[model samples]
Target: MKKKFKNLTFKDALFNIANYTVFFLFTLACIFPFYYIFINTISNNDAVQKGMINFIPVGINIRNYLALTSVNDLGVSFVVTVARTVLGTGLMVLASAFIGYLVTKEEMRNRKFWYRFLIITMYFNAGIMPVFLNLSMLGLTDNFMGYIIPSIIAPYNIILVKTYIESIPRELEESALIDGAGYFMVFRKIIWPLSKPILATIAIFGAVNHWNSFIDSLVYMQNAPKLYTLQHRLYVYLNEASNLKDIISSSPNAAAMALNSKVLKYTVTMVTLIPIFIVYPFMQRYFEKGIMLGAVKG
Candidate 1:
């Protein structure tokens, strides 16, 4: 079989090479920006200033990272961001999964209407002012609840999950009922276990969203510097780092500090991304299976 497969004609070999070339170029296009950022992060300030840094680091330096960690409020913001990602993603996945399952039930009254209502929400949203006003009414402004609550129910995730769940074989549910299993039991034992891939996908999506969220934090967290998330902290750092020349003219040590802040921005970006990257590989196997199972034809 190997010999036969390897015995391709010149035309076939050309086609295969062309296919791989396109994919390789596409992959490089996607990856080059990240590579540039990484290189820039480690390159020397003088070299960076001279526009010498390209795909490679000109003079390696760790100053940017050191400066970032030395900032007073960054540590607190890191912890806050991690906590929000965990709690917010957990709540979102659970709520979405339950809602998905509920909506998939054919016998449920007004199911179509509920699904349509949920889908409509994805297209239309109350503006930031209304959201802020509502949060203030609920006394959630400047609170962690403000960050986590508003994002708990995602309409798009709900629709994806619902479509997946509806694809589950009805016979499986009938079998569970015949075996004297209640709806909850069937869901817990079978549906939940089978839905791990989609759950992981949703969890990762939610976590990434929560971790990167800055607009909500900025709008709702008035006078609450301690409540700033990692993204917000990074944003502030970048802004401060850009203005470092003026800051350094007043204080000689500020240039070194700014350099450190630049390095730290890269380090923090890597740090924030590492957890999700570690998680995704393990979940990927289940994700493919779950998606296929959830989308199985009747």
Candidate 2:
């Protein structure tokens, strides 16, 4: 066996080596940044400020975490972020899945027109000002609905899912119909089950998007601090810390307080990132399947 393996062509050996090299390098590149951030986040403020820490933390401390969790609105913001990510992602996935299934049906009337309409929206979104105006008209501004509603239907995801569903053999649908299964029954029992890979992909994408979304929450729900997401809370904290340092510089105690703010920033960033990072590994296997689902022709 060893002799036979060694006798493989030079071209095959070279290809295998090159493939492994590229894969190793790619993995290192992806992991290094997060490792660097983790090291820096744990390092003391003075060590971080002096650039003394690299792959390993220097003068390690948990004071940053203490400062972060001790902040007035951090708890509220955390709760809001969790709720928004779950609800928003759930709604988007359900809507995208149903719409994707519908649009993939060749027998559906005006399927081509609906597909073109969605493709158009994917390329040409109404500007933000108009979106805000429309939201204002609907009284969704400064509410939880504002953040969740606008993100419920992503055209790009719908298209990806549609492509994946289109790859499924139509013979399956015909067989189900022959068995007297209605359209709804076929979709729920057959199509949805078959479309798991794409659905998982869309779910992960939507969940990550909603979890990391801060700008929309900031712009639309500005008036509702109670509804502020983690990102928005971090933004507000950074702004407040900056302003406080500037205003309170003449006071001795305030200067020391601002030194702590630097630590808090890194800690809060780590805290916000940790939950999402933890969830990612669980979805990693599904993610590759989902991405590749629509790429290959059936």
Candidate 3:
């Protein structure tokens, strides 16, 4: 590599510089939002409101976070979010794999019909009004079921898993079947193990979706505040925090109240995003490999 670089022309050097510059800018652009949030979260409330805190935190402060700790429903939202993320991701991955595997089986009756049916949904949008009405009809409103059921089986995820499963040689499962292993046994002992990469990839997708989703919670759980997810609760806090002017006017601790909402907003954002940030690095390699194998290899 050093030898090749030594022989490079001016044009080659220019191209290399341009490539590095573009990537540097892109990386900065991606990182800036988090940095801005971090600096603001740590900075004084007045600094944030005056647009004084930028890339660097101007004045160190933790009052906003202190106030956030005392806020109601924060703990409840955290529990709801964690429960939904774990259960929803597991169920989604299993359902995706089951649907994906079923479609690939040549012997399954109506294989073509099922495959085409699932694929068609991807290209179509069953608008929000219809989806909400259907959920309401099913009595999912004002319940945790509203959070999990709608996203439990994603068509795109199923298609990805299906492609990954198809790439796996079928002879192993067939051999296991010939040896008297039932379909479930073959799937349990063979298919699932081989499909771990793609499953891990889809697991991240499902978990992120479940954790970040607030629209479902808003639309269905408005009447059931106990069922609110962390995102929804955070949304409420952010909105209130942004209106510090109103809060200061009515509060006894007008001086302290001014900083509470704004600071809490930034802290809440960090808290909400913490899980994904913590888990992502570990899953990234598998996610990349799975995407290539499941979505591109076929």
Candidate 4:
């Protein structure tokens, strides 16, 4: 059997065409930079340096990627970045979910005040020096904990989680309590599982932030090369001639091809972005749904 299409009016057809055209162009605009960078990274080093490689690759090879393996501290930096993203995202989601659950409880004393206190920090900035001094005083400076501790309690995430939990029927919690479940058990058995959408959304946010963070490492971990995240190392690799030269010299392919700084920078960027690219597609549905629903009630 043949399926029949509904007839469309001229205005409707025109509108649909315009909408599709606009979105197609917008998508292309978004994808082009990454595409351009990727082709440049794989294209011949001389052409890339001379800006000859544009829409497509020329004399493509994997030398730039192979060269990256030889960078000093690259392995350690990769480890640090992965560790930070995983630990930071997990702790942040848990803290947000727990605190979000707490604030939704009517019986928790001073809940409003505590919520306000947390939200207030989001609005205020104590200059960088003060924050640095505070971290130094607390022994977080030069420590991996510097990344995890400061980001664990994100107020914005808490608000989203709290709002999301509020949208859940109170009858669920009341029924659990009537069954003699304590608040913690009720939360663990009921609320936590239900909040998966928002939690996944927060995890995406936290992971991206942690993965891309370099300023914290730059400021606090300057003396601790062992603690450098991938982004910070990339920053150093781009800016420091000695570091770039040493890294290039260490890679036989990079040395033979004389890979320029531009190729190195683009390759490192794509490498850093690869994990997020792999992860986001799986989580995108939850992200869109959570953000919409989370925003609706609040």
Candidate 5:
């Protein structure tokens, strides 16, 4: 049997065309700036400075990256960045999942009160001075824990995890409980597996936050130069040349290899963004579904 379909109206066709055209334009607007930066990064420094490189390359040169990498501290910064991203994201995801699961339990005392308390903190922030003073007193300042410990629990993430858990069939946990499995066992075997989507979402959020944040390192690790993050290093690169001599000293042929400090900024920016670009694509599918599912109220 042949299926019959109604022909599209002229108005509807025009509307669809307009919508797609707008979407394409919007995508181009967002992407072209990054593309322009990439073109500039690889283009000749003279061409870039002369404004000759725009959406197209003038010449290819990887010298910016080479010069940037010649700095020994860049390697240290990269290691620090990776460490914080992994530990911070992992802790946030685990903490949110566990706290979220606990709050949803009927047997847990003060569930509503605890939930309300957490939700209230989402809108309420302790002032920066107070937070800094508290962190100083606790010795979290100038410590690696400054990044991981403070960000382990975000109330919004907890809510998303809890909402996602609410959608899961309770009958699964009930059956496990009937089989003499404890709550932790049930969570380990069942809830954790089922909650992968939201976990990935929260992980992405936490990872990006830790990767991009520089203020914590600046304020907390003021006395500790070795603990500066990649982001803080980049900020220093942009604002001053005090560190350039240290970097230049690393290269044996430093006199011949001209380091274009101007273009190095773009190269460093691209480098900073690379991990996010790589990781986001893998999580994108789960990310979309997770946010939607987490938004739904059971």
Candidate 6:
């Protein structure tokens, strides 16, 4: 590596410097927002409120986080979000894998028609009011199942899984079947194991969607605050900070009133994002490989 660096021409050296500089700036840009928010949340309430906490913290404290713990309904919102994300991701992965595998079978009746039907839904959606009416008719409105049921079958995820499965050698599955293994057995023992890359890819997608989703809660749980997801609750909390301040000021919770609203907002934002930050790094290798391979063919 030292010898190669010494041998580089002026043009090559300049190109390498430019490439590294661009990537370094881009990475900094992506990371700066989170860092800025974090520093403000830790800064003293007076400094944060006076807008003096940029770039570095001043008189750092953790009161914002402590104050957030006292917010009403936060625990329930958190439980709902966690439950939604876990159940939604697991069920979607299973459904996508099962449907994806089924579409690859030539022996299945009307396979093309069914596959095309699924694909077409990707290009179109009924208007929001019609969807609301449909959900109402199905008795899904104001229900927790409303969050999971509508999202379990995603066409784009199915396509990724189906394309990845098709790339696998058919003989492996054929050999499993030759040993008297049924379709489910072959899937569990062979295909499922071999399709980890694409499955992980879809899992990441499902987890992120379910974690970040608030629209469903906003639309379906408007009258059911008990079923509200964390994102939706946070959305309400942030938007209502002005009105909330007056209420909190009169309350007996000194920690809640002492913390600046902006600081608390930043704290809550970090709370929501920390889980994704922790989980993404472990799955990134699979995510890159899976998306690339899945997109290459379809």
C-alpha local distance difference test of each model: 0.76, 0.80, 0.84, 0.89, 0.86, 0.88
Give the runs in model 5 whose Cα sits over 4 Å from its true position. Answer: 1-6, 241-246, 253-255
Clashes of each: 10, 0, 0, 0, 0, 0
Q: For model 1, where is the 10-residue window of minimal lDDT? A: 244-253
Candidate 3 segments exceeding 4 Å error? 7-9, 59-63, 242-260
Q: Rank the candidates by lDDT, best first.
A: 4, 6, 5, 3, 2, 1
TM-score of each: 0.83, 0.86, 0.89, 0.93, 0.93, 0.93
RMSD of each: 3.6, 3.8, 2.9, 2.2, 2.4, 1.9
Predicted structure 4: clash tally: 0
* Deviation from native of the Cα of residue 152 in model 1, angstroms: 1.4
Score candidate 5 by TM-score against the native: 0.93
Error of 5 at 122 (Å): 0.9
Per-residue CA lDDT of model 4 for 69-92, tens digit only, reads 877687799999999999999999
Residues 1-298 of candidate 3: C-alpha lDDT, one tens digit per residue:
9999999999999999999999999999999988888889878777787878887787686655555555547878988999999999999999998888888889999999988888898889788889889989999989887888888879989999999999998899889989999988887898899999999999999989989989888888879998899999888877776553354435444445555455666788988987889988998989988989998654
User: Model 5 — which ten-residue stretch has the worst lDDT?
Assistant: 1-10
- Number of the candidate with higher lDDT, 2 or 5: 5
lDDT of 5 by residue, 112-168 (tens): 999999999988888888999999999998888888889998999999999999999
Clashing pairs in 6: none
* Model 6 Cα lDDT, one tens digit per residue, 248-274: 565565434465578667877888888
